[model samples]
Every structure is written in C-alpha cells, then in structure tokens.
Target: MSKGVKTITDAEFETEVLQAEEPVLVYFWASWCGPCQLMSPLVNLAANTYSDRLKVVKMEIDPNPLTVKQYQVEGVPAIRLIQGNNILASAEGVMGKEKLISFLDTHLN
Candidate 1:
C-alpha cells in the first residue's frame, strides 16, 4: 500500500501544501520526539481515512527548519490544518484518530 504519510520540506511546502487544491493536514514532527513517535501511527491512520478529502503531509522539524520556523512550530507533533494557504486551526501533541478526525472536520467543513 502507498504510505499516504509524506515528509515535506521547505522547498515543497508552498507548492505541495500552501497551493494545494484541497485542504491539508500537516504533522510537524521530530524523529527523537517521544510524543511525535507515539503519534506516528495515529497520523498514518488519519491519512488513510482522510486520503480522499484532504492531503496529509508530514514535515520533519529537523530537516525543514525554514518552514518550521516560519510556521512557529514550537513543539513536536503539531498538527496544522491549512486551506487556501491559510492556517485555519492547529494543535500540538499526540492526537487519537477520533479526535484528529473531529479536529479536521472543524477546520475543513
């Protein structure tokens, strides 16, 4: 199966996310972050569930410093919902599948 989860970088952030035709769910994470690691599977599940509705993109905080700083992501496992190049809502830390879905719903619809 294709891993719906993708690691986005600074260069691709604009075209791949900000300019996306559909809404975007971005998970800003770090490999060494405990919460981020724990939330990986949940993020993947959300990606699969919402694959048809929104784009689920993962950005490694360490690699995408520019975007990270630009977004002011101060914590790992920060989930940002973006549409039309604007951040509608965001939250940090681990999120279960249900809560994540609800959060997405609040922003997308």
Candidate 2:
C-alpha cells in the first residue's frame, strides 16, 4: 500500500468499500501488469488529493478474485468509483494523472 491508499482484500470489500461513508475509488491491479505499475503513482496522488471526499483502496486482482468477479473487472489497472451499492463510474487500462483527475471530477462532483 502507498501513502493515502489502503490495501483491501475480497473479504474486506463489503465492510471497507460498500459500507464506506464517502465515495470510494477502487483501484484494481495485478503484480505482473505493466499498466498497473504505471498507474500506481496517479492513484496514490488521487488518494491524497481526494482524501477528504473519497476513500481510496487498492485491490490486487490475484488474491481478491471475489471482488474482481463481483465488479466484473476483466482487466488490470481498472478503476471504479462506488458509493453504497451503486457504481458511479468505471474504466479500464492506464490513465494519466490529468485524465484521472478529470474522471474523478466528473463523477465525484
């Protein structure tokens, strides 16, 4: 886990994400994915930047298959913005910092 980001597992998904008080930014990644590695920094930045309004969590796809399947996350570097039982927004692949910010602004605001 990086600064401002909490590592979450499949078993903790419900308690940590679905039950969160604020919107949660879920970053789905895997150890062997290059794009996942590339997006880590941007995700970390988002975690810090939106700490007050958002809960940032990282889920490794391998160990968290339950959540991955539940979310229909078919690829690495997937991003999902969820609040309560609703999924507000989602995307796949690596996104740059600016694009990431724009995406958050669109869904979060």
Candidate 3:
C-alpha cells in the first residue's frame, strides 16, 4: 500500500469512512484475489493524486467480514466512494488509472 492509502479494519470502518470529513474511497479486497492485485497500483496512484481531496482506505475482506457483509461485496477489487454516512458511488473489478480517477472525480465534483 502507498503512504497515501490507509489499511483499515472492520472496527475502524465507521469512524474512518462513515464519519470522515472528506470523501473516502474504500477498497474492498482480499489478499488472495488476483484482480485485487492488478488493481492495487491504480488504487495507489489515485490515493497519491487525490490525497488532498479524498481519503483512500484499503480493507481486507478476509479479516473484515462484517464490513464486507454490510457492503454486500461479492467480489474483490470493489470500491465504494463514501461521503459522510452516504455511499456516493461503487464499482467492481480492475480499472485503469484514468477510469478510477474519473470515478472519483465524478463524485467529488
């Protein structure tokens, strides 16, 4: 994970994401997922580029089942854009850096 990205757990989900002052981009992934691995770099890039406007967090689904269940994440490389208590947008699968940036930009603006 990059310095701009934070690794969060189920216990910290509410405070880190739900109660965050800025918009949060939560990456729901598992260590064993190949697609998640592929998407990691793009996520990291987004984290670095959007550090000022967004809070990027990675949540390993294997250890954080409660949050995964709550979000109904059936696959790895799932991303949720959350602001305050609301989920603004969500996407699944591996995305390119441009697409990921566009995803965030759409909701951020």
Candidate 4:
C-alpha cells in the first residue's frame, strides 16, 4: 500500500469502506496476480491524487475471502467505488493511471 492508501482487512471493511464519510475506492487484489501488480502503482497514485475526496484501500483477496465474496469479486484487480454502503461503480482488469482517474472522477462529482 502507498502512503495515502490503506490496506484493510475483512474485519475493517465495514468501517473503512461501508461507513466511510467520503467515497472509497477499494482495490481487490492478490499477491500472485500479475495484473494486480501492474495496477498497483496507478491505484497508489489515485490514492494520493484523490486523497481529499476519496479514501483508497487495498484488500487482499486470499486472506479476506469474506469480503471478496461479499463484493462478488470475480477477478483480481477489481476496483469498486463505494459510498455510504452502496456501490457506485466497479471495473475489472488492469487500467492505466488516466483511465483510473477518469473512473474516479466519474463518480466523485
């Protein structure tokens, strides 16, 4: 995780994302996923860039099966924008920094 990005667990998912005051971008990833490694830097950048408006978090799928199942994460490198316990938007696979920013912008405003 990056400086502004929080690495959350299943136990913290409710408070960190569901009840968050601001919008949260949750990155569902695994240590062995190639695309997830590729998407990490961009996620970190987004975390720092949108720190004021969005709270970014990373949840490792392997150890947090409950959260992954709850979110219905079918694949690694899944990105979900959540606000007030609702999912605003979601995407899967590796996305570039610009596209990731655009994704965040789409729901933030």
lDDT of each: 0.85, 0.93, 0.89, 0.91
User: Evaluated with TM-score, which candidate comes out highest?
Assistant: 2
Report the Cα lDDT for candidate 2: 0.93
Model 1 vs. true fold: TM = 0.91
**CA RMSD of each candidate after superposition:** 1.7, 2.1, 1.9, 1.9
What is the C-alpha lDDT profile of model 2 across 3-108, one tens digit per residue?
A: 4999999989999999999999999999999999899999989998888799999999998888999999999899999999999999999889889999999988
Counting clashing residue pairs in each candidate, in order, gives: 0, 0, 0, 0
Candidate 3 stretches greater than 4 Å from native = 1-3
Q: Which ten residues in a row have the lowest lDDT in candidate 2?
A: 1-10
lDDT of 3 at 68: 95
Displacement of residue 5 (Cα, Å) in model 2 is: 0.3
- Give the number of the best model, judged by lDDT: 2
> Per-residue lDDT of 1-109 in model 4, one digit per residue for the tens?
3348899999999999999898899999999999999999898899888888889999999999999998899998999999987999999999988898788888987
**Model 1 residue pairs with clashes:** none
TM-score of candidate 3 relative to the true fold:
0.94
Q: What is candidate 3's lDDT per residue for 6-87, written digit by digit as tens?
A: 9999999999999989999999988889989999888888888888788999999999999999988888889999898788
Each prediction's TM-score versus the true structure:
0.91, 0.96, 0.94, 0.95
lDDT score, candidate 2, position 12: 93
Order of the predicted models by TM-score, top scorer first: 2, 4, 3, 1
